[model samples]
Structures are given as structure tokens and as C-alpha cells.
Target chain A: MTTIQNRQILLAKRPAGMPTEENFSFVETAVPKLQAGQLLVNTLYLSVDPYMRGRMNDRKTYVPPYALNEMITGGVVGQVEESLAEGFVPGDIVLGNFGWALYNVAAAASVKKVNPDLAPISTALGVLGMPGLTAYYGLLDIGQPKEGETVVVSGAAGAVGMLVGQIAKIKGARAVGIAGSDEKINYLVEELGFDAAVNYKKGDLRQQLKEACPSGVDIYFDNVGGTVSDAVLSLINKGTRIPLCGRISLYNLEQADIGPRIQTQLLINSALMQGFIVSNYAEQAEEGLNQMAQWLKEGKINYTETITEGFDNIPKAFLGLFCGENTGKQLIKIADPAR
Target chain B: MTTIQNRQILLAKRPAGMPTEENFSFVETAVPKLQAGQLLVNTLYLSVDPYMRGRMNDRKTYVPPYALNEMITGGVVGQVEESLAEGFVPGDIVLGNFGWALYNVAAAASVKKVNPDLAPISTALGVLGMPGLTAYYGLLDIGQPKEGETVVVSGAAGAVGMLVGQIAKIKGARAVGIAGSDEKINYLVEELGFDAAVNYKKGDLRQQLKEACPSGVDIYFDNVGGTVSDAVLSLINKGTRIPLCGRISLYNLEQADIGPRIQTQLLINSALMQGFIVSNYAEQAEEGLNQMAQWLKEGKINYTETITEGFDNIPKAFLGLFCGENTGKQLIKIADPAR
Candidate 1:
């Protein structure tokens, strides 16, 4: 057998604040021969999510921190190159938590087959995969958007936020989006059918948000927590529900920023704010995925992705998340599957 | 009917910081003649609670803000001196939302009879009243404490906090109390049967809290929000529940204080923090009060009070709440049951 060489990216240093390309290093190594019950997979698509930033810090979050000088692990859609397991065959598309590399050696149990007939294979890492399920349970289970109620989502053009807005609309609620750029705002309102969208960088956020949500915010899907969230929180109605998902805006800060306390706001309004990760509802993953896929098939929802070509750009794609450079799901398109 | 002069307390001014005696003004008014379905009640005990602090700031809360120059209203246990309604009663102990006055004229339907045979009539304003229900529903409903979990209550010596700790214990959870004084801490551990207690005034709150809750906090009944709540928040375990019942520590501030943001902490742990007034569970008030009464009857919970004598001292007792002067339920003992 000719040894296949793998190009892997590793965490060179733990970031103090904003991460730079210097924090990552690339190395070339020969892919290991698969043991029985193991499969050799070729990376086709890799997901770069805001949550990966939390893994970079030495502190533990819901998931354990990524160790320094180790291969970074994330969601990757791959094609089985060779398999020793009974269920998987060569040329089968699979999804697994694999390294930022050209190839992965995984136990057959760790990877699941992706049915291409449902959607594009890349959607397995984004719209039909983890991000989709995240938006599903977080918004429906926690947010509980009611008919005619207002649901304001921050990071509205991001993968989860875009789905959150459309799902709110499907529930007969008024969907409002808060994004950093007017271009993303346009995509949220015009493309995703959000009732209103605000550009946090443009004018007065409080006034713009007030004009957007005339009836007051009933459910706030918090993704980017900072001054933009501060503006949305001030407009919460009585019985408001805030699903605390991700705080990407605060992920890279060296010093924790002090802000206005929201406890009193929640108190006076008799509101509820609950934080959750998708794995909290891991038992219902299949059900959630089916529902999200149905919405896609019925044209009740739309998905957008910003794909960067080649494996070397994964770190740059991830860093761009902090500056709101990606449209929706950011992905690194590795080589296409070999026949 | 001869005119009966009533000594009523009104909101003289909205306090910018800590409320003083100057914020309350005494006015003399005549008690009107009783019409059909009316009762003339003599105030026996007036309950002073931390929640009233939010109502005094001229901002709308769960209850509307106290209007300036109007009478200050709160929980009052009274003796019906005369009644023209069907429940024909003289010397019947009753509970009503009444003004801070020596006497109140109320519609018969507005006040509920307090049975003296069950407990002291004052218990209708304390342990079996709004404060007790606040503690019960907030801790049991929102906190949802599981057996063997560690539950921490801030402002642990106050009316609601004291009851929250005891209810947590009733649910078979380990109860930890956070108070300001050594005397209060000793009371919590000795008299209230708290598994552990921390004095915020003592050296190293974080160290003391860590030692007290070695397993980390599973539930935090936040009665006083500020630096103490922040300290408790930092040590939360996964799936921790925080019921934001009040924020007495932050109420008197001239300006909103900037503090460490808690959303990230909540997100990382997949925790929940809900704000609620007791009225949020108004439909279940009777059931909550019945359960609380049963617990009291079984000696599973205890009650305490710090009674200030005379109607003239109501304002002083209210002001003392912010300074942590009361050991338990604070009330004014106003001319006991008019014979």
C-alpha cells in the first residue's frame, strides 16, 4: 500500500485575546494504517463555528478545553476511503468529530453515514447537522416563540441565528434580527424573511430596536452577547424568555467586560433566561434533524453558507467569525470525494 | 358616624439612593362611614419587605411603582372592628393589602379572614403569607431542587431567604445560607439548620462559599443581587437553577452598577436563572400556603420575626431592610387587636 500523507493543523498557542494565524501550525504526516473496526476517511468539508473559540481557552466550558500543541477537533464531513467495519463501505459519505486534516482514522462507531438525497453533503456539517439541531431545541424548547410575539435574535445571519428567525416565523411570531452589517441585515430580512432587522454598527441600537419591535421583545435568542444584547434586553416584555446559546462577542476578550446588570430586568418582568447547549437534548437529535430537514424540504426555511476553498484556510475562516466576515455557516471545502 | 382620625403614611419623595424618613410623610385623614359590603379594620401588623424597595423607585415592576404623595401600601394584618357585610364579624382577624395607616376601610371581598386558632394572626402576614409563598414557589417551582443537591440562598436571614433555605432542606437538599453578620450566620447554622453558612462581611467570601458548598451549588435563591450573587454564580455546577426573587443589595443604588456579566457563566454550565414575584404563581397561592402550613404544623420549618412597636416606626423598619438590620420577617406591631 502507498502511504497517504496527511496535512494537519494544531494549536500552537492559547490565545490571550484576539487569535492570530501565529497561534496555529501546520504539519505533514503519513496517515496511519487502520486497525480492524476502524475506517480511513477523506475530509470533504470542515465546519468553523463560533463555539470552537470557547474550546481554545484553557478554561473548561460545556466541552473540555482543547489542549495546547494538540490537533484541533471539530465537525467534519468525510468520505470513507477504506473500511474494516461491516456497515461502512468505500465511497460512503460520513460525518464525525475529526481533526483539521486531509484524512482521519476513526472507529466505525464514531462516524455516521450522510444521505445525500436529503440535502447537500456539506449541509451535514451545517444546516442539517449540529447547528440546525442547536437552533431547533434552543429556540423551541427554551425560546418557545408564541404566535404574534416578538423574537429578536443576535448574530442573526449566522448559522443558528438564521434558522432561529425562520423558525420563529414558522411559529407565527414576529422575527427580528440583530446583525453587525447592513448586508447581513438585508439577508436576514429579505432572504430569510425576518420581520425586521437591525444593523448594530449603523445607528442608535436602542432606537432602531425599539422601532423594530413595537410590541416589545417576548423571546430573545442571545448569540452575540455584548452591547447589542444590552439593547435587546432593555426592551423585553413581561414573561419574556431568553435562550442563552452562545456569547461569541465575549469569547476573545482578555478582560471580562463590565455591563449593566440584567437580573433586575428579568425580575421586574417575571422573565426567564436559560442557557443551553445542543447536547442537552441529544436524546432528540434524530427528531430535531428530521423536523429541520422537513422545513428545508417544504421551503419554510433557507440556509446560506460561506465556503472557503482548501484545508489551510480553516484558521482564517475561524478568526473571521469574530469580525462577522462569514454570511452563515462558514466551511472549509476540502478536496471532493474520490470515486 | 363620628369622624375617626387616621394616621396615614405617604410617599413624600422618591429616594435617589437610600430612602430616609424624609421620603415618608404622615397625614391625618378621617375614616369614612361604612357602606354596604364595607368593613372598618384596625391595623394590627404591617409587613415590611425588600420587594417594596423596587416599588419605591418610580419605575414599573411586577406591581406598579408607588405613586408620589399617595399612601404606601403593603401586607397588613388587621382586626375588623365593624362589618356591614354578610360575614358579620367584630374582632375577626383579616389580611388585606392596606395603606400604612392606623386604620383602613375596605370592601368585605377585598380582605380574607385569618383564623387565629391555626397560628398567630401575624403569621398571615409572614410565614403563611406572600413572603412564605415567594420562598416556596420560587425555590420549588423555579429552583426545582433535587435531593442531595446544594442549595444556596442569599440575604439568608431575611423574610423570604430564611424560608427559601428551610424549604430547600424540606426537599432533602443541603442548604447553605449567605448573610452579612456573624450573628445571622450563627442563627442560620444553629437555629435554621442550614448545612453551611457564610458571612459576606467576613474575610474571603469565595473561599468561605467554596468550603461551604464543596459539591458546588445546584440551586441559588438570589434574594440579594450584587457582588455576593456574582460570587455564588462563579461556583455553579452544571444544571444549576437560580430563582431571582429579589435584589435588595442593588435596589438603593443611585445609578445602575456595572458588574461581571453572568450570561457566559450561565451558558457554560447550561444553567437557568428565572425572575419571579410571588404573584406569578397567584393561582397556586392556596396550595403553597397549605403545604407551608402543614410543614409548620409538623415542625419541619420554623418562623421568626423582628417586631418594631408603633405605627410611627413603619418607615424606620422599611429603611432598616437595606442595611440588614432585621433578623427575620420585619413588622410593625400597631395597637394590637382593638378590643
Candidate 2:
């Protein structure tokens, strides 16, 4: 029987503080034969998200930590190379929580088939997928931005942050984005039509944010927590809503992030602050996807992805997230299935 | 012309930390004549609450700070001595936001008439007043404690805290109280039917809290924000609701409280923390007061008051709140209107 080589990345060591390339190890193994109800999938695009950094630590979070020397699992868009399961045929485009491998043998039930004609297949990993649903539910359900309200989003150039700002605008609220780079700030304001964008890495963050949100922040969709959040919390209006999506700033920190305790701030303004993960609204995912897809069709929404070429570059692309390297969803293109 | 001598308490100086008797100044002023739409009111019962501490500071809060040398104004039960206003008549009992004095000249529109026969007139300052409405709206609206959930209350022996625990029991939730003294804890568990009560000043707070709330805290009515809140937050269950009412413990602090940042805790559990004032539900205050009155009539609710006699004792009654010297609602019986 002929055997195919599977190139996979495993967590070699748990990260301390900021993660380095040495934390991951690349291995080659023979692609195993598919058992009953299993399909052989060739990974076309693999996603690298900030949340995955939390899984690298030996701690309990919403999701379990990735075990050492094991294949790191995340969102992957793949093509069925062979199928021993019903309803899935070879050449079918699919999305699954699969291992960081060039080739994956997964249970048919574990992967869902994606329609190639809907939009770019990679979006199943971004705007129309987990990242997209995260932005949708966290902003709309938790933040609850109302018309004429100022909606400030931290980490505004990232996958979820970018969408949160745009959705705030679509809902008739002013969108103010806080990004790290001037280019990301410009992209947010000029391209995504954000009302205002502030480069947190440059200039006075508190002054820029105060100037941007003259009406005071009514809704804050927090994708990056830490000092940026502290500044935003200072300018919150009465009845302000804050949806705690991700604390990307604290994800890689070795020590506990101390604070100007926010309890007083919340108390003074009678505000609401809530923390949530995307799966918190899993029951409404389908509805979110359909609405997002319609918005995409109507030109009411736009998306961007930074695709790094080659499977070997996944670790490098992920490390860039901490340094604010990507403008949108950061994905690794392993191979072109059609080619 | 008959001149009435009005004895009053004024904020002498902003308290550096915990307030002292020196922070208040006793003054005697001649009562000014009532205006066209005003009435002359004789103070009967004056409320001394933890929230009053916030108004003593020069800092801007939900309520404006009490100015130095100006008569301190708060909730007062009074008898209309004379009236030039349409809705008010002489000899009628009323409630108003009036000066902490023996006599006050107030606009008739600023004060509402209280039925003398409906329970004791003092109930208007305790269980059927601001404290009652605070517990009703904050617990039911913000806390949203469902049946069978573990509801924890910090400052559970105080005015609003005691009512919050009783209302939680009425909603079929397990009520746990955190008090400063063993006597207060016993009162909460024994007299109030609280499922459990912990003396935060005694024993290991975290361990005691963990033992008290074995099912984890689903709802935390936080009247005291500081280390006590931090402990309760640590044991919060998924979807925990925290109503930020008051922070008596931190009220006297000269510096801002730092933390184990609670953003991560809220995020991980998908919990909600909301800060609200009773007036936020002013549109429904009537509904809340009526419901609380019905609860009292049914003997489903009970209340306690630490009443210090004599008008001269107002400052002392107010100062005792910080040390947990008073149980339930702390009030100063300035005078008996019938006497």
C-alpha cells in the first residue's frame, strides 16, 4: 500500500512569557489509512489565532491546554483527498478543528463540508467562521451598541476587532478603533470606514482616545485588555456596555496582570462589563453566519486576511500576532488543493 | 414674626480616610420663610447610609459632593409644618431629599407624601424606602438570581444587604451573607433565614467563602467592594451576576484599590458585573415599592434598624456605619411628630 508523508507541528514546550519558534517542533509521519467513517483531508489553509497562545500554557482555561509533544489543533480548511464515509466525497471542501498537519485523517462527523461557491474557502477560517462569529456575538449580544453611541474596539486591526468596528458602523454607531500600526489605523479608518482609528503604539493613547470619542464610549468591544482597556474604561458613559472578548495583551504574560481595579469605574458609571468566548453563543452561529454572508453580499461588510506562504511559516506567523504583525486574519497556506 | 430655630449638620471637612466627628459641624440657623411653591417641614427620621460617604468626598460621583460649610442633604422623613404649595398640607407626613436638620424648607414637588397609617412612618426610611427599592431593583433586575442558584451578598448585615438576602430567599435561591462581625453573621443566618453567613473579619476569608458557597456563587450583590468582593469573585460560577451597589470597605481609602484584575474572571465564566443606582429604575420605583410593601404585609420580609435617639446624635449615627456598629438600616430619630 502506498503511504503519504504528513508534515505536522507539535507543541515541544510550553511558552514562558512571549513564545519563541523553538516551542514548536516539526515532524513527518506516514498518513495512516482511514478507518470506517473517516476521511483523508489535505489541509489547504490553517489559522493562527491569539487565543491559541493560551492553549500553549499548562493552565485550565475555557479550552484545555495543548498537551506537550502533541499536534496543536485549531481551525483548518481542507479538501477531502479520500473518503470512507457517506455524504463526503473526494474533492469536497471542509472545515474542522484539525491538527496542524499538511494531511489529516479525521472522522467525517468531526468535519463539516463547506460550499466553495459561497465565498473564498479561507473565509471559513475567518470572516464567515469562528473569528466572524466571535465579532458578531460579542459585539451585538454583549456590547449591544445602539445608534449614535460611540463604540470603541481595542486590537482593532485584528480579525475579531476589525469586524467589531465595522459591525458597530453597520448598526449606526460611531466606530473608534485602537490598533498598533499606522498602516492598520489607516486601513481601519480609510478601508473599513471606521469613524476614527488610533495607533496605540504611537502618541498619547488616552488623549487620542478622548479626542476620538468626544461623546464618551457607550460600548467597548475589548479584544486587547490591559492598559488600552484601562484608558477606555476611564471615558465610559453611564450605562456603557463592554464585551470582554480576548485579552491578547495578557495571553503571553508569565505573571498576573494587576490593575487600577475596574470595580469602582463600573460602580461610578453604572456600566455593564461581561466576558465571553465565541462558543458562548454557539446556538446562534448559523444565524450569525447567514447575516454576515448577506452583509458581505450587500457590500455592507469587508474583510482582509494576511496569508503566509508555506506550512513551515505557521509558528513565525503566530509569533507575529504578539507584535501586531497582521492587519486581519492571519492564516498559513499549506498547499493549493486544486493544484 | 415667629422665627423657627433650625439645628443642622454640615460637612466640616472632607474625610482623609474613615470619617470622624470632626468631619461634621453642628450649626443652628433661623428657618427661612417658605417660598410660593414650598413647605416648612419638621424632620422626624433621617437616614444615615454608606452611600452618604461618597458624597462627602470632593470627587465627582453619581451624586455631587457635599460642599464644605453647606448643610448636608439626604433622605429624611418629615412632617409638613406649614405649606404654601398645592399638594401639601400642614400636619401631613412626607419624605424628601432635605438637609440633615431639625427643620427644612423644601419645594413641595421635591418631596412625596407618605401615608402615616401604612406600617410605621419609619418604614418609609428603611424597608419601604430607598434601601428597600435598592434591594428590590438591584437584586431582581441586575442580579437576576434564578431559583436554586447560590446568591452571595457582601455587607449582608447592612440595610440594603439584609434586604437583598431576604429577597434572594423569596426568589428560591440559596442566600449567603458576608458580614464583618460574628453577631451580624448570626443575625443573618438565624433571624433572616440566610442559608449561610460568613464573618469576613474572622478566619481565612477565601476558605470560609469556598466552604460557604460549595455550589459556587451564581449571583453576588456586592455592597462592599475590596478584598471581600475579590474573594467572592474567585468562587463565581459560569454566568454569575454581580450587582455593584456600594463599596463601603473602599469608601474610606485614600488611594485607589489595586487588584487581581477581574476582567479575566468575568471573561472565563461569561459572567456579568453591572453597577446601578436605585434611581435608574425610577420609572418602576412604584412597582418595586408596592411589591416590597406586599412582601412585608405577608410577613415574607422583615427589617431591623439601629435608631440612635436625639437630633444631636445624627453625626454619631452616620459615623457608626463605617465600623459596622449598626445592623440593618441605620437611622437617627430626630423627633416624634405626634409628640
Best by the TM-score measure: 1
Clashing pairs in 2: none
Worst 10 residues of 1 chain A by lDDT: A249-258
lDDT, residue B45, candidate 1: 94
- What is every candidate's C-alpha DockQ against the true complex, given to 2 decimals? 0.89, 0.86
**Residue runs of model 1 more than 4 Å from their true location after superposition:** none
Task: Assess the local accuracy of residue A192 in candidate 2 as a C-alpha lDDT between 0 and 100.
Answer: 97
Each candidate's number of clashing pairs is 0, 0
DockQ of candidate model 1: 0.89
Compose the digit string of candidate 2's lDDT tens values, residues A1-339: 599988999999998999999999999999998899999999999999998998998987788999999999999999999999999999999999999999999999999888888999999999999999999999999888889999999999999999999999999999999999889999999999999999998878999999999999999999889999999999999999999999999988778889888988999899999988899888989999999999988989899999999998999999999999898999999888773
For model 1, residues A54-127, the per-residue Cα lDDT tens digits are: 88989789999998988999999999999999999999999999999999999999899999889999999888
Give per-residue CA lDDT, model 2, range B1-339, as digits (tens).
Answer: 599998999999999998998999999999998789999999999998888899999988888899999999899999999999997888899999999999999999899999987789988999999999999999999998799999999989999999999999999999999999999999999999999999999989989999988899999999999989999999998889999999998999988799888998898889999999998999999999999999999999989999999988888888889989999999989889863
